[model samples]
Target chain A: MEKGSRRSFLVFSINWATALIGGVLSLAAGIPLIGFAISPAFKKGESKWVDLGLADRLKNSRFKKVDYTFTAKDGWVKATKKRSVYVTDAGNGQWSVFSRTCSHLGCLVRWDDQKESFLCPCHGAVFDQNGIVVAGPPPRPLQKLQTKVEAGILYVKDF
Target chain B: MGFLNERLPLTEFSAHLRKPLPKHINLLFSLGSLAMFLLLLQAATGAFLALYYSPSPEHAHNAVTYISEEVPFGSFVRGLHHWGASAMVVIVFVHLLRVVIYSSYKAPRELTWIVGVLLLLVVLGFGFTGYLLPWDEKAYWATVVGVEIASTAPILGVFVAKVLRGGSEIGAVTLARFYAVHTIWLPWLAFGLVGVHLFFVRYYGSSGTPQNTPEEMKTGKPFYPDQVFEDVVGMLILFIVLAAVALFIPVPLEDVADPTNANYDPRPEWYFLFLFQLLKYFQGPLEIVGTFVIPTVGIVLLLFLPFLDKSERAVLWKRPVALTVTTVCVAGIVGLTLLGASSPKLETADATIVQEVPQPTEDIQKTATLDTETAEVEKEEEVFDFQLTEEEIEGTEEEEEVFDFQLTEEELQ
Candidate 1:
């Protein structure tokens, strides 16, 4: 037998029609499945402000580790979650708050007083006291959080 | 043999095994069979690991730790799965390189080559998904960065990341999703594609050696002892090397995942380090270029190579264009991997100058950016001077460029 044999018109049309029917049926079910799977992307993370403590007291502290819990929505589950941040007093009325999370990869950075720098054990990424990249492969400085001091209370926004 | 021949197709199989192979075929031709051997090894070990493995953010780390520390030869099996993964990637790539060098992917073997490339991708998919199963800090964070990188793709990035993550965050669902894909979906895909690949291989029959003529191949030895023996030997060597690696360098499991730990590092597995490092060169909106465009184009071009390479030339040096393309790509991947591997490992002299616990933000940048100030500061005490990146300099340098700094900073350097 030779290669590249041509098929009859009936067979050609039937094959094409069969594929069309299959595609239509598959798409009819596949679209909804895809939509259901991707539904989470459409939903935004719930954000709220978790109060830390008094703003004045938080100011001028070398590096105060502040852990706080807040009610938040994670996927379909809504519950209370605990989070932490480093609060350092920026000379003046300004209080600088930095999220201990490394900006590169989400690794918790520990404040090493011996090194006097925020050290990321995961990648050896060093962040200076002010949350600036002193060394290693952090793409950006330690993530600085949005801070608001109301009256005598200190608060950092958490998601 | 006589008893089995009566009950099974043993005689026919033995007859099939005696198929003729080109005499010119050598060790390089055995890489395909070696790759398949590694796949089988992976499948067997992965099944065993899955029996004890738990896929959840809460228990996955514990499960892996238990397997590594408690179970007899568990660490060995886990290590095989881990190192075997990298070995598989390496062997598969080398096999492809061999195919390219010889014109084996040409003509009737085009479908086989295409399917082979797809199989390589499935292997890579396994690597990506498997990295998340341990659910340790490293696994969790690396997957976070990986998913984030996925989210950087244009149009469908969000959907892609969410689907990969199985939800809004990399938590229990993400682990389960990765586990299912790694243990189930990928194996099925690999097995199916491998079947197609093997079928095509048999259908096309060896493209024969690039140097030999079909007439010469007619006078070659049968596949029974010559080729199969070589294939088995290659596999034996691979297994020995793999065992040595697993015994000496067991895979590490870092601290358990903590959602609230802001200081967690998100370094991707080594196989993905090249892509992770590639993203460093791209910033902001340009991330899509590195994340999606380049990879998509690379895959498409790789898929179409057999069609494009009309040069039926088989010898490595005969095709100048193919040689150059392969050289550049191999160099790029190697260079990028080296760069990615070395990322986040930089250590410098400690600043014993007063505890900068609350160091002035400018002081940190000034010491790193200014050579003169660093010299002056070093006069008093040892201080680590860090060169600022262009992005960092732009953010803080304009106010301090009076130090007469170069526009270029050691970003990657």
Candidate 2:
């Protein structure tokens, strides 16, 4: 081949090689970031059992407020956080723990002794003592936290 | 003469000394290259995005959220893809207008102009399809408007809408179809059209000084070194601008899909808003004429332009008719866009105001009377008499009344 053609070919080859390397590296770096951006749905699965404290502390005939902490890990990063909620007995000696997160919207629900129900401040969604939907645009019952007695201590799912 | 007569290789193409390009390549000229660069950027980022995007309606919103939040710098990548698309459309339109003003569409270059117009339509199709993939409220109804417009076409409207939507309604099928069109089909067409357009530009070469230039007037620089440098510098500046936009203001997410709600104000992206608002002005019979007929006529006119204006003159100043028409068209577009931006407050035809009618005075009086009568009846019933007969008292005193209650009742009778 002539020198000019060979030189042009070399330049084209180098340009293509650089582009290919850059593309591959970008893909390798970008996929994970894309994955991270969509991690909220996946994070749903990582929610685990959180110990809220001793079952004895729960007041009978009323909801007792408890605060607890648990660890969450996203890939290499791990975080420990505290969250509070109310715990009540469902009248059959069975404990019913509900998430403060409102079902209608995500506002925190507080126990209203006067109304004898859980009331959401953002909207007027009311839940009965057993966490059954009583009124308002809630559309569903409050989300029940998965709980168990571990050595007489109440542990509930944090998410 | 000896130096000029020296052997030149056949492989080396010689610059046409008879024609030259203008030296004053302004910012307007840079738009085409910027658009092309943006197209490439969009394609790259879009391809990356497609790898992680889930096309199911159930998962599409979640997947987009995941990509934005969980993926490292995924937000930035998606932002680049988004803003790059907007930039492409804007830059292409500006470049087309620049060509129009210079009368670059005259004679042999008409095919280039036609292809450029098609590129604009394809870019719009890209926007339409890409908007639907997120499966959010804004994406959903914007697509609904798009499908409705497509369905307005005579004879082939339903078919085209179905083909684009992938079914009777928007769902998993629609999402997949839009994803395919946005990521695969439209991009392929655009890439091919762009290649042909660029090839023609290179073959015909740049349209130099306007038609009225003196014969002795110096034309312009060659394409290789000087124009190439300008293009590179423009691309670098465009890259910096795009980078800054992507990094600082990531694309905003809207409320997630809730199909039952009808309150969403479905507007197309800002670039297409003018066309959307244009549809509004053409009402009733005129709508069909304006939306479909007029635009179709314009496109047909644009395509057959080379044959229509066969004059060899390329001078803008000499072509008063063409220049006037071009200026009028541009001014009309600018006016329509401003009107569109301002006229969003105009009520949509489908929006209805629900007014509660007050109850009549007679009905209210009748209800009050009924309540009062019911209360009086309750009060009357509360006051009951309690008296015992003599026979009942005697029966209570006798133990025999328990055993012979029938006999006692017969005696009383």
Candidate 3:
């Protein structure tokens, strides 16, 4: 078998063919699997410009707590979620909305009027009016939500 | 020419590279090399991932998201890394099994066997630590359970758990520590052990097979072309399979680590499911038996196997006791892992943990005090429910509705 030309050729083809087939088949199954796996990573945390009522009601340079409900599309099912934000008038018709959820551990944060800071009771994390961490173990400032105003109506994104 | 030749052993090295092995070498023999290839693949893909991965809790999940979504071929590389690690685990186990069945860990190869065991432990450590780097709910909770299990070790339980976690809880410190161990520590350990294992293999040469007689071993074929060709073919097949798996069944990255989400069920990676299953049988004080004693005994037995099986005959039939014991252990692992995988998670006694805090609710009211500079705070204690019911825990209904098997909701979004 070693000396025979046709036999050696057959052996060579078989060996290489096995490898080629394996490579081809793996790709056939793998490409779609990989595509399916990575699809979620590409999904941007989408939010809609949900109306938060009259923009005129929000006082200039003052923070107001706003609560709004929107249907959140979570994968296949959509659920009506009640979300809150702190909307502060930016002096010139613009409003900065901050998510009420604390940046530290997802616990809800409350504006402590006496303390003059947003306080998280879970770990005593404190944030200033601008949403920056004032004290404690909160890594960063509270997440600010995208806000928009149109025709005196205030709106905030669910992102 | 003489000086150059003397400085480098190129001629001798070339001669050594082409050294022959017994012609009886088969595809099964190539499993170890295939495992080696997968390890290299993991290292390469891991390096690519590390370029974007941030170990801190704040950016770890975001970094992973960026890698998979933003960087070109980042998802592809990540998919390869995820699936490749799983494949490596399987191949490493199979390779170990093959070594056992072949009785190749006998006599002069005792050191090789011991080193191989250490390598397996390192591979397992890599899986455990890497599992946490994703910083997802599953990763977070699973590490919590894993660390808790470690803390159950008799005298050194708390110490070991503290060392593994870097603190009392799974947080930023834990994530950074795990990242360091997985990327820097385990790879170095594997490389060092692999170098020594290869040295032993070369120094002793191929053990060939028990089937091959002394005379047959003398007339073996060269390692470079014949055996190397078989290895190449095997690796190609493995690559194709790995690629298909990566492409078709990419691993899911669940929601970022949220300790508050009680709905999430914590399960270990598939390899540890057997031991995870074992823990179910012995609860409370006897938990140590499951976590420490049984596993310790099993590993001790495996380490001392070469000495225990004193028979010179390497044939499977000749070693009845060894064969039965190995078969039983393998069967136990498979059975337990499958059982654990299929079993619905048992309910914990306290699913809901409530924390009281003053929070802004559906309504807010502000009052002016005497000073008026700082508004009078309304202290309202609200109960934040973190408990999940059995109904919520069984979330498979919605996940099944989206895609049968192609992608889970978590993977989809």
Q: What TM-score does chain A of each model score against the native chain A?
A: 0.86, 0.67, 0.69
User: Measured by TM-score, how close is model 2 to the native structure?
Assistant: 0.56
lDDT of 2 by residue, B133-217 (tens): 8888878767766675676677887666666665444556577768877888898999999999988877776664454354423
Models sorted by DockQ, best on top: 1, 3, 2
lDDT of 3 at B16: 85
What candidate 2 gets wrong by more than 4 Å, as runs, is A1-159, B1-27, B211-219, B310-318, B344-413
Real interface contacts reproduced by model 3, as a fraction: 0.00
Q: Whose lDDT is higher: candidate 1's or candidate 3's?
A: 1
**What does DockQ give for each predicted structure?**
0.12, 0.01, 0.02
Model 1: CA > 4 A from native = A1-21, A54-56, A61-145, A149-152, B1-16, B259-266, B283-285, B344-413
lDDT of each: 0.75, 0.65, 0.71
List per-model TM-scores for chain B.
0.81, 0.75, 0.84
Query: Which candidate number would show the highest DockQ if scored against the true structure?
Result: 1
lDDT (Cα) of model 2 = 0.65
Q: Write the per-residue lDDT of candidate 3 for residues A1-159, one digit (tens) a residue.
A: 776799899999999999999999999999997665334334445445555655665656354555554444333324344456666788777678778666643455666555667765333467898888877555568998877654444556655
Interface RMSD over true interface Cα atoms for each candidate? 13.7, 25.1, 15.9
